[model samples]
Target: MLNFQNKNFYQSLLNLSLYLFVYYYFVRVVYVYYKLAKYISLDFYRVALFVPAVIFITLAAYHYFKNIQQLKNNIYLNSFLSLFAIIVLSIIYHFIFRLDYMSDDVFSYQIKNLSYSILNALLGFYLYQQLNSNSSKKIIFVVWFFYAIMLLINLNGFALDTKGVSGVHLMLGDTFIIISIVAIFMNINHKILKIISLSAVLILAYLINSRSSFFSFLVVYLFFLYKEIGLKNLLYLFVLMFFVAFALYYFDLLRINKRMFGVFQGHSDGSLNERMEQFKYGIEAIKNNWFFGEFAGQAIVHTQGYRSGQMGAYMHNWLSYYRQFGLVFFVIFTLMFVYAGLFILKEWYLKNTPIKNMLYYLFVFEAVSLLVFRAYSFTHVWLVMVMLYSYIHDKNIKNLSEKA
Candidate 1:
């Protein structure tokens, strides 16, 4: 019932997922070991990722060149325009509206993540080209198996209060994305398997008290499981929620209580005030470069009447990107999703087909995620883009083959 025309495409996607998993672990392992390598001169672990990364990049590049004509079709071409404009504008504002408080750490962070964004896009494009029906099942199986092992590692680390070997130092976000991806895949059947995975993850997410992950679980519930629930189920859900709240309170680990119970509690506590300050600072920082917004990790060329350090506070709010980065870049960001949506839209709605509905709903869920999380610089966004657009590629191949 998977309903895919190209098993090879699916396999490639699974491979990409595996690729991300390996890359992240490799980078983090190297970074961690490199730190303690002073005794043994193990710098090789530091740059070991470049070996596999370079090979995959080269393989992807070859495939990209082989499909240059098809790859540059109108859809990809238009999306590139959006990508190009955004990057160019980001660089321009970074230089033109320079902040004086830019630190070396911030500058390097931005540039490194930017480079990663391009590489992810290219790798995704390459994976998309290698679509075939005979794609390996082994890759998909491997990803799932690896995810199971990683999940255990994460859980163990959480229990022990130890930094995970999942590349905490270098690619924490990627690790989260990979976990979510594999979890989602494993739960595609949406029954006992789904419940088991969700329940385990939900407990872990709550035990760790990550509000974002908790919120993500809630959103996923609404997206995938809402329709199946009834009023009677709501009663059960409330009971479950009550227990969850009690457990969190009993354990004293829930960090977002202020945000959750500010009115009843009658006072601001914990991160609520700090989060508000960051959002406020982000909005104020954008005024420095009203058009293009503040540059990433760069000092404010001239920030008057504001503490220079305040401008650099961590931005946790989803809209902080729009508030801090500028409207033009926001529009460009919006275009990325829109372009992903435009692919093949199916000449017909093709009702009653599980495949069609799944893709449609996936995009809907994706669009909704923008309001909840900002992922403009994240490779996961590119991964989703490739996943969405591959349907278009399959459609194109089918149409051409029929004519032939």
Candidate 2:
């Protein structure tokens, strides 16, 4: 009995440590970005995030290895194989095109981006596994509390300096927090508390003025309400959306020429037109080098046509992966997305597990939002996609065997 108790205590400690580290990491990133809070350097922030992620990944890897027998029953092997193929192809594209040969900044940025992606992938997989383990409500509550703290910090930042936060940061941060809230709602079966919490989360999303967050909320809510509300309610929602679009157009909120919008529009004089020009240049660049495109490190400035003497540095297109690598790389990258989507749909139609269904919708919503609104090349989006794919693939195999 004493030994069992000690084992339980150790497990609890490990769980708590993981929770706290994740909470701190996410909250700090949100605070720094939204608050316009300064970090010493991108490298410094990367180290801060990467260290805790490495610790978490080590623990998770150990747990998986210890439970290797269970993995034999799962399709993790196939999922890992697919992931490896994608990485190998990416590496080939990197070296063959001499992608990082142009400048030190390009190589450094790519390294940091890759590091963040791997860390997020590991963290997301661990979280997904934990969700399937014990006491989900407690874990979710802890996560939500950290999310709330992060939201408060972001709001405080905006209140202090209206133009401080970038459009991309606002979109990404709010999307992450809102998704966490949605996950909690899905996992927790409490009707009243779930309604209350969800409403609060919606309000928070609205306050952030993140178009992506708003769209995600609409997508998730309508998906949940679709069958029950029938076509009439759907029509009403469509009408509402139409009016909102009209209002945005009338108010000049919707700018198609430039890939920018939101509160920061007024503060920066050249930002709107600059982004538009960058998008235009990106298209031209892609046209010129459609097959192999430019390397990742090329000095592809956005100020080519502008005689106004504005210094443009980075490619604002998150989809710039196509130009950075090539059409071949883009095709492979797209196939991964297609595979993930089809796998999720298959699981949803067959097994129909609540967790799987929620994840499916989340993946769809996030992918669409990324394409429509902002460019998050270095964010946790890819990692989240990988985790979702892995989970759905595993669950599908499990269901098939159970049926057999």
Candidate 3:
């Protein structure tokens, strides 16, 4: 069903590559950091990704140049101007105060992250030019399918143990939650397959033991499912689930975190408590250097002692941006996300299309995760942000043309 014309083919390839990177970039990070891939060096992974990205960019640039007039007013590219400006200023600030502000290694890592983000941003913009609801669905599903297969091959089964359940780590839970929710809500004809898939993912989420991901999955799933099946049906389903939960709890079959509910009382599991502590530290760093933000202080804290390397000891939320990239950067990124989210809500209200529903749910998940779970600089976050922006831009243009 994919359009394989010259430009479309290249753009689709770029799209596939970007999705692959987003879905498994965390896997790459884990593998490199843990030295798990004995046959594949970090440099090999870097080169593998970097080379393809460069080639994709080159081909995309050629197509854009060839169709300059048509592609000149790309909303996706323009939307990131403020973000790009902040990035430039941050880089200049770092260079000027390199000695006083940050170490060479930290700076290098940041630069590398920024470079890849920019490349991904470019690819996102290119894909947006040809993107539609159907294509978006295909790209996501295809990448998720392959990633699932990769996990199966590597683990030989689900990775559920005393350490926890994950395709690799907590990251896998996040990815699985998104795709699973989408799959559940999809209007596919095969009811048996859909039910089986949803059931499988629900079990997977439970086994993962990620309170954030499991509850998030339940929230979105139940909310949408209620709308689809109505309140009466939902109540019946809830009653059934309640009895199931009671049975599981009575028999000690439930494996969920015991402290999951303690978050309401400001006392939760260690990981939840640790995230709160990180937020406190992030706030202190921001306060210490309000204007430019205090990466050096955060870096020092992370380096002195942490589970994840210097860059990994973040608050896992938007505060990470506030602590590292300065208030201006935080404000710009926040506004962009907020505006895009509002646009999707509006579109869903007016049209109520399946694509719009998917977008809205995705926005909900990303918004919640970014506020309390996922880090600000996550590659998938950036991709989703741009996708929202492009969809908004496309809708606005279409409305304008219709009016004219």
Candidate number with greatest lDDT: 3
Please, what are the lDDT tens digits per residue for candidate 3 over residues 1-404? 22235855665665755554453444453453345556677687777677777776676566667666665676555558667777767777777877443567777777776776767566455444434556565655665566555544444233334223233446666766665544444444354565565566655665555666666666666656555567898899889989998898889876444545556666646777677777887887788888888643445444344423354557777688777778887887888889888888787667656557766777777787777676655655675676677677777778888999
Q: State residue 318's C-alpha deviation in candidate 3, in Å.
A: 1.9
What is residue 369's positional error in candidate 3, in angstroms? 0.4
lDDT of 1 by residue, 56-118 (tens): 666555555655665566664466557655766676565575556655565566666666665
TM-score of 1: 0.68
Pick by TM-score: which candidate is best? 3
Off by over 4 Å in 2: 1-21, 30-48, 56-103, 149-175, 178-182, 190-196, 234-273, 297-299, 305-318, 349-353
RMSD of each: 6.3, 6.9, 4.8
lDDT of 3 at 220: 60
**Which digits, one per residue and each the tens of the lDDT, describe model 2 over residues 1-404?**
00123455446435644453355445455556555345466566656656666766676566656666666555544455455455456555664665322454555555556656555665555456556555654656666666666666656422322245455445444545545643564576664555456556655665555555665665665654453356787689779978987898799875332222443445453655555766776677789889876544124563445322122343554456676566765666666767787777777657545576567666666666556544434455655575676676666668888999
Superposition error at 159 for model 3 (Å) = 6.5
